[model samples]
Target chain A: MNTLFVKAPAITLRFVLLLLISTVAMVADHRYRVLEMPRGWLLTVMQPIQFVADWPAQRWHGWTEVVAARSHLLQENKALLEINQQLATEHQQFAKLQAENRRLNELLQSIATSSLPTRYRLARIVQVSLDPHTLQVQINLGSQADVFLGQPVISSAGVFGQVVHLSRYSAQVLLITDSSHALPVIDQRSGQRAIARGDGPSGLLRLPFLAAHADIREGDLLLSSGLGKVFPAGYPVATVRSVSTPVGEKFAEVVAVPVADPGKVQEVLLLWPDRAVQTIEEPVTDDLVDDQADDGDHE
Target chain B: MNDVANWRDGWLILTTLLAALIIDSMVLPQFLGSFRPDVLAVIVIYWSLMAPQRVGVGVAWVAGLLVDVSSSGLIGLHAMVLSMQAYITLMLYQQIRMLPRFQQTLFVLILMVLGKLLAMAVLGMTGRLPTIEFWFSLPASVVFWPLIYALVQRWRKRALLPS
Candidate 1:
């Protein structure tokens, strides 16, 4: 009885202390956002460590960039040159049609919305997740640029992801290929509505519950439906790769490959639309009209 | 002489523990991060095994608190787990001390995994499991146990021996 009494007090005290601390922490974390300030401070303190951790990968990337032979660069340059030439020709025609469309829109009393001045902020990819389970990338864009939560990010090819968390000088993006990520997408060919969800590791997107008889076919381009309003409409989301169905299934399992070169692109553009532009010039309706006029003018 | 050796031992252990905390939080890739060997856990466990008198549940609690604060996880989560871990390690110190180094490492590994799994489960129940990367860091931590033991043991021996 004496020995038990001696040990019990110590154990009870320790247990009580732990219980008190846990209750305080849990309550504080749940009740107030006061912890976020300190958490952010900790992140800032840990930034140096993040930089050092990234050094190896950055160095490896640098080495690869340097070791590419002149011949390969020349070949790439030549191919780009030809592509640029074709694009330049297309651009000239597009500009002419655009000018004519603007004139017709003015005549039709269409509201002219000034284009939002998009500023390009270059960020280096510091960390990339190789895990097939979660597709996320951390970039070096801090909060200094006003990159807020839920900002849409895109590579030159297409929409990449969105800024989920932003530190002072770093942000974590939830890429389009993560299982938890879903984007409202439309079939370019049939205008069928469906949601595109990321299927991790395979780097593919699954458009689930697509009606078995849905007019979706392989090679059909998918664009942002913008139902969520997070992403601006008409951006290329993915290209339909396959459409399949099991016997008696109501929905065809539609798979797509994202248009963005998720592996290669280091830099991405953050779309920050001015509220004034969004309110005035609905780009989707304007662009559709311009496309129709251009086809008519060409014929 | 024993006191001096012990003092040096304390300093060495403290420094290594701090380094492990910083490295575990900082340098490790988030993909391999969850299993990033529980550097702080290993350090605390090692110190508890080596010098139970110097390190105890309080030390574990404080160290765990630091880990919790730095981990971006719920506050006190690591602190509670770590304190419990230390207490458990302290309770089993005699048995752990007698085991071969490899077996000791395996025991430590199991404890580390338990801590991680426990933390994750708690977080999950709270609806705050941040990322899947959290679990991936375990294997890396397990793999690092032997190396950590060898290095720390060498350092301990060097400091304890006459200079």
Candidate 2:
């Protein structure tokens, strides 16, 4: 007790020193962007802790699958086969349409839509962010798996998010529904482009910049405009939930719910859009390029 | 003999801190995200009061940094906030230790609320405002304090005493 009293001054000194260090670190991280390398290294060191935390849930899920009744598995398999057949037929039509579109673009002499094909890799959510202020999730894929910053991630249903941080074995994704996230979206029905900004904890998006008389309506589908180039064009992003044009207001109060639910997403796909076409001096043959695109789509 | 006791104390505290870090990073159901208690804060508060010599502001700051890295957040946010909490706990540990259990829990609730507000202030400075559910952890922390306090006490008793 007496020693505790004597150490009061020491505690003050330690607190001041630590606080100063923390301020410097925060400024460096948030403003300067110089601490990314060290942050990545630290994430690598902390991987084991996160892995242990994720293990129980993963094992329980696996255990439940193993013990699940045979009838249930059979039913699920049958339904999945039906869905697979439907997708295969749809994909065949899509391939033919894509070729026709490419021929039309060539005749019109327009820049080919994303000169290179996009590749996707599968990943699973290993951890959800602890901070309630941010909506981010950690995926099992990382730099070791060639995951890079700003790479787009999507679920089977729609656009999910983009990778923001990378470690050796894991990466953190900034979900589209995060408050700080804004995406360029176009209404599929009206072809009107608007910015969809996340509404934070409400898990909704707000189009605050659109004029009151803009051509948006409730139930309209929003797709990625590809204007940002971060996400590919034509991916479903959200569906407009409500549109309210307040009297005498410059902007309409529009809200939307994300098509992809972060809560139910067990797996996500990371996308890689090939962007290095300008430097090539030799002209690549079209059939060869189409073959490559087909291979990329197989993933 | 003093060296051996000090080493044991370090081992005990480090193990508990590691557990807190794991639980803090574990995935939970979406509805429980707002209600999840600040397990590291509670552990740091408990240890800084009971074993002030072993767990001080330095340890608290490092714990906070680990949290920031694991959460992939702005690096020093938690470090600064948790250091402030540990500092207050250190400065007032003697008085807090002497209070009744009910009063101690009340004091903890106040401390947690203040810590939450401080974090919000920092985030607000960065131009991102958290939702109202950010404060829900304060009540959850209050509910879990007695359990954490008793658990840490048992470990302290088992590990700190000379056999």
Candidate 3:
């Protein structure tokens, strides 16, 4: 008779009801995205708190950078500037080559028009998820910034991921290294395209579908093939790490390491595909009908 | 005086929960970002035990929802776990609060494990099974409970002191 056992079974009933509602909400949210509007509004409400939560750490980080050795910082800064200039020069050359490709394809009456640079917006990562399987980060830019679902996200180093969830004030970017993420990529050296998927704990992408005799080899660069129309074409995705084909196996096992430095990146650039000039990423296997017609006309 | 105590305890609960969420969501990411303590769940369990009348099922539900939203996970996922934690505390508050601090920590350890299991179930139902990193967090949450409990206890005592 020491304990006071007050009659408050109503809490249990409320718990059950809340549980049922939440479970149903999870199913509904996952299957139909029925709660997007509400979730977006909630995120807008929560953004300030997130900022406050992130403030101390971010400020501490800022102070450390400010207080760091000037000599070391200067050396790193100079090297980065040099790399930036080199990349800018190489990018100009790529643009010129693309222009020439468009002109030549136009003269040949081919439908292949070079894909231009995708529209982009910048977003700083506000918070990162602690779950290993769901390697996601919330960015400050969202629907208010015209950040939409399925838009590809990239850092200066390489492709980071794609936007999976969009809120009014912020959005979640699912990293390419997440187990569920896969992208169609082509080996730059061999021109062999394969699907690369994140290997859960390994942190490297697995190309499980390449044929036994696929031209993939060690150290080949893999670029996004842009097959899914989600990630833009001609961006560096990952570099081949190892290729293993068991003697009796029908398919070759390949793995690649992503180019982005996941540890240090704080901001991601979101690229939205231009709906007007959607370029296909297929191999040019169509017949040269215009050449035949031109030859006949000359004859 | 009783009402004032309850109100002070409620404010303490709110601040502690907010701080827990901040630590749980931020400051935990390493290179791959896993195996961090479930600070938010542990705080919910602690507060629900310490002040069940104040931090009831409704408060727990909202706290869980906050974690869900902060992590940008599927909404309502943490809400379910939180409500269960609060409900259990409300039902057994009289018995549990009377136990020693060490026993209470053990109880919290079990609750955190169950919370982890429930989270795994929800995740499995929704998507992929969490890696070993997520499983490793259960014990880490146990290790964290004492420190969090001490800090929270001091905060609560200070808040309840005569002004």
Candidate 4:
């Protein structure tokens, strides 16, 4: 059993060599495109593993479908139809507002009219990264359907995350609740601007620089300010959950729960909105274009 | 089974590792996310001890690489961590095997936590401070070691050997 290769020091040698290689790879990945090709291929190769991993969950989901009662499906259908009817009712008023806004833009001959018509596609969550530190999810849509890096992804209810990486058949979205993620948000109640950063997957956002006496309150809705030009403006990002100021602390430790539950989103909305939402083309613009000021997000 | 001289168990190990990878990446209910076992880590630990020559540092490195890729994480991140884990297991296999089952579990708890902390350190150095869920995974994985050990043993008896 005592092979020469199995000598005690051999294990140390292998471990050190492999660790050195891995560390170099990680640093290279973080700093440059040095490893993108290999990384992409590895993910592609591992696709089947992920697919097979998904099989049990997918099968379990199918089982639920098989046992679903006819009455239950019927009830679900009816409820969905009713919701559609309500949305359609809201659509009529939105089209009128859109026309009026167009007219106003024409009269003013402003850059707001330069905003391009936007389109969006639906994608399903295929995999969720199990790493507790990095909050990311893999969606079924990829470069095939015009998915791009930095494109904004939203749930039907509100803004969720941004697409970070894309393969041919899948993409990864970094959730706003990740610690490294920061977003520009405006409080709907007071129109106060603050930068909301994720504290981690407790599903809450922290406003780091807001003054202790800022006119913010619990239950205030925070919307994308669009200052970052990544997430479109006026989508609900989070709702204020708490506000606190420790003794002598300069900024209020304002806490908020994300309006879009990263875990609960079955399908994501990939938006193709223009860079500025209005793209005033002004270098120093602070306000998100007010052309869609009503901000109902009809589409 | 004991009398059999055959050592052709490659397929059995591969299937278990594949299953482990799948289970690790599968999406679970939100409440269960915290309790999600590090299936791949546990499996690597089990195999490096059960059959060190077959599934040593190199096998563990590949397993870690697969996890990093499949999870869509930074490349080589898990490869380094899992390789370290397997190395430690190899170093202590003899002593660990001699311990009682409960003590074996206790040792596993320490090893799992240490590996997790090392991975966490790598993330922190890369400027990503993971959520509490990441921190919670150590305990979660430690709790799953006995199950992994038993499963590997069962596979050994049921598939690897002929009765």
lDDT of 4 by residue, A1-299 (tens): 43423456988898899989998888786654356456656767777877776777778878999899999999999999999999999988987887888999989987535343277889988854545557788888876776766678899989898876666667777788876577899999999999888776577889988988899999999998877777777899999998989998998889999988876777899887765345535321222122233221111
> DockQ of every model listed?
0.28, 0.66, 0.52, 0.60
lDDT (10s digit) by residue, model 2, range A1-299: 12536378877997899888888998787665567677888888899899899888899899999999999999999999999999998988987888888899989898736333356789999854556667788899898987776778899989898877788888888888887677789999999999888777788989878998899999999998877767778889999999998888899999999999988999999877665133233321110111232211000
- Per-residue accuracy of model 4 over B1-163 as CA lDDT, tens digit each: 4224224467767888888887888877778877777888888888778777778889989889878866768778889888988899899888888999899888878878888788878787766756676666667787788877786677667764456
Judged by DockQ, which candidate is best? 2
- Candidate 2 colliding pairs: none
Alpha carbon lDDT of residue A203, candidate 3? 70
- Candidate 4 collision pairs: A133-B130
Docking class of 4: medium
How does model 3 score by TM-score? 0.86
TM-score-superior candidate, 1 or 4: 4
- Considering only chain A, what is the TM-score of each predicted structure? 0.73, 0.87, 0.83, 0.82
Candidate 1 is scored at a TM of 0.72
lDDT of each model, Cα atoms only? 0.69, 0.81, 0.75, 0.76
Candidate 1, A1-299: lDDT as tens digits: 11211243474477568857776876575444245455555555556656765677778778987999999989999999999999998888876776787888889887643333355566777753222224667778766766655677888888798765456877767788876577889888999989898886678989988889999999999998766556766789999999999998998999999999777887888777554244644432122111232221100
User: Whose lDDT is greatest here?
Assistant: 2
For model 2, the stretches where C-alpha displacement exceeds 4 angstroms are A1-6, A276-299, B98-103, B160-163
lDDT of predicted model 2: 0.81
Candidate 1 residues B73-101, lDDT tens each? 45677777787777777777788889998
Clash totals in order: 8, 0, 0, 1
Candidate 4's C-alpha runs over 4 A off are A1-11, A30-37, A106-109, A112-117, A127-129, A187-191, A211-220, A241-253, A274-299, B1-7, B91-110, B126-163
Q: Tell me the tens digit of each residue's lDDT in model 3 across A1-299.
A: 21234358677778888988898888877665567667777767777678787787788889999999999899999999999999898998886787789889989988635465667777888754534557777888887876766667899888888776677878887788877678888889989989888775567889987899999999999998877667767789999999999998999989899998666888888876665235434312121111232220000
- For model 3, residues B1-163, the per-residue Cα lDDT tens digits are 6567777886777777777767766655464345677778888888777766567788888888877777777788789888887787778878888899889888887777777788889887755777676777777788888888888788767766876
* Model 4 Cα shift for residue B48 (angstroms): 2.7
